[model samples]
Target: MPIYDYRCLECKKRFDVFMTYAEYGNKTVVCKHCNSTKVTRKIGRIRIAKSEESRLENFSDPSSLEGLEDDPVALGKMMRKMSGELGEEMPEEFDEVVNRLEAGQSPDDIEKDMPELGDDLSTGGMGGMGGGLDEDF
Candidate 1:
């Protein structure tokens, strides 16, 4: 079910109703105030609003990265913004990587020592491994 917004022409009452997508545009919306059936469909703000998932998807699209390699600052800022929004603290390894890159250190000099952080369950690492087979059987 999708939420549809409608405005009453007679009373100018705006309201949301949950209905199927097919029925949304065709359904007659009535005003709650004066019981007027003359209602108009309002353009929803969400129609153009990109969700967090959609934004992430857009960023990850390879086709969108045409000339991003030439701008290192932009890349760093984007990474930092993504990290902040994702509630992920930059690992010490990442700090080292950034520092090394800034200090003219080669990619080979930057050792990968990313320590696993945070609750494993919350991070969705290892889960659903076992069952109470002894008790059930």
Candidate 2:
């Protein structure tokens, strides 16, 4: 589900709604304060934060990662298992970070000095997964 921004042409009121992709396009989103059908779609903010457990769960499961894991040791092993299943080589940096992790170094500690190591640390490292927002949340 995603939060969508909408503006009511009748009332000139802007509001947000939480709904599935299908519902977003098909449903008639009316203004909460004023019931109006003349709504226009607008881009809404996306929440990207994942809890610690959610992060771990994503790392542990190959299915969720589309098999991008390809390290023989540490998280790389898990990634490799996933990659083998998905038939793709995990990103080179992913394997490097797994090597560091296997050496018993904390990701935070490594990330402090080498920011690049933190690239794909969360989810598939698509970039900017944390909850903190640039604008006021």
Candidate 3:
């Protein structure tokens, strides 16, 4: 048996139904709140699993990031999305930079404020994966 979500048309409330696959269409769904038979099935969000390769591939499309070099906010948004997909821990400074970008701060201004950002986040030496991305990656 599985639970299904539904909303009552008359009472405008939501409820759940439990039925076997064979009894789905054959069952009479009624609202628990008001005994309303006029209920509509509600589709919940569905999640799908994907490979890491496929996820990182999305960021490799240069066309999708057109003019990103000129827009800090857009760059920050993209970076955030990429980080989520990467599912790896990033440094606090990385978060700070992204936050600054999202705040509409120009890259030059952020860099000036955190002069060591480049040298510290350099690919050759990430704060030990705890601070930045690995060079090999």
Candidate 4:
């Protein structure tokens, strides 16, 4: 599948169309916004996918971390970028934390409001208690 950009002569609007090879030239391309058949296909810029290593390398740049600590929104943006750079999907709580930070809430405040946000389930909070699996035995 290839996406093509078209400029409508009647409405002067630009839109993208995704079509297969078989559909190309078989049907007339029309402007989606104005439904105008007087449209011309234009060359669109190609997108390049960056590798995980390259993305992580960009995240480690000193400029990327600048003002991140002082500004909660900046910190949240940085965290979002880091989450995108990672190969694996981030946990749901991760997004909630970022959203709270971006909304001008401090990490301490967020943690206090959402106690389970960073709960150390492995340590069992009070002590190094197991997952109560021993009771099943």
Best by the lDDT measure: 3
- For model 1, residues 106-130, the per-residue Cα lDDT tens digits are 4333333323311222344312222
The order by descending TM-score is 3, 4, 1, 2
> What's each prediction's TM-score?
0.32, 0.31, 0.53, 0.48
Q: What lDDT tens digits, residue by residue, belong to model 4 across residues 8-55?
A: 999877789999989988989988988989999876444348886786
The full ranking of all candidates by lDDT, starting with the best, is: 3, 4, 2, 1
Clashing pairs in 2: 67-82, 69-79, 69-80, 70-79, 70-80, 71-76, 71-77
The clash tally of candidate 4 reads: 0
Record all residue pairs in model 3 with backbone atoms less than 3 Å apart, i.e. clashing.
none
The worst-scoring run of ten residues by lDDT in candidate 1 lies at: 128-137
- The TM-score measured for candidate 4 stands at 0.48
Q: Candidate 3, after superposition: displacement of residue 128 in Å? A: 4.8
Candidate 1: C-alpha RMSD after superposition: 17.8
lDDT of 2 by residue, 1-137 (tens): 78877778887667889999777567877888788777888653334465656545544754554423242235545544444444334443555566676665665665776675455444344233232322421
Clashing residue pairs in candidate 1 (N, C-alpha, C atoms within 3 angstroms): none
Model 3: per-residue Cα lDDT over 1-137, one tens digit each: 89999989998777899999999999999899999899999876444477989878988877888888799999999888887787765665677888999999998898789877766666543344434545643
Query: Candidate 2: global Cα-lDDT?
Result: 0.57
RMSD of 3: 12.4
Alpha-carbon shift of residue 77 in model 3 (angstroms): 0.3
TM-score of 1: 0.32
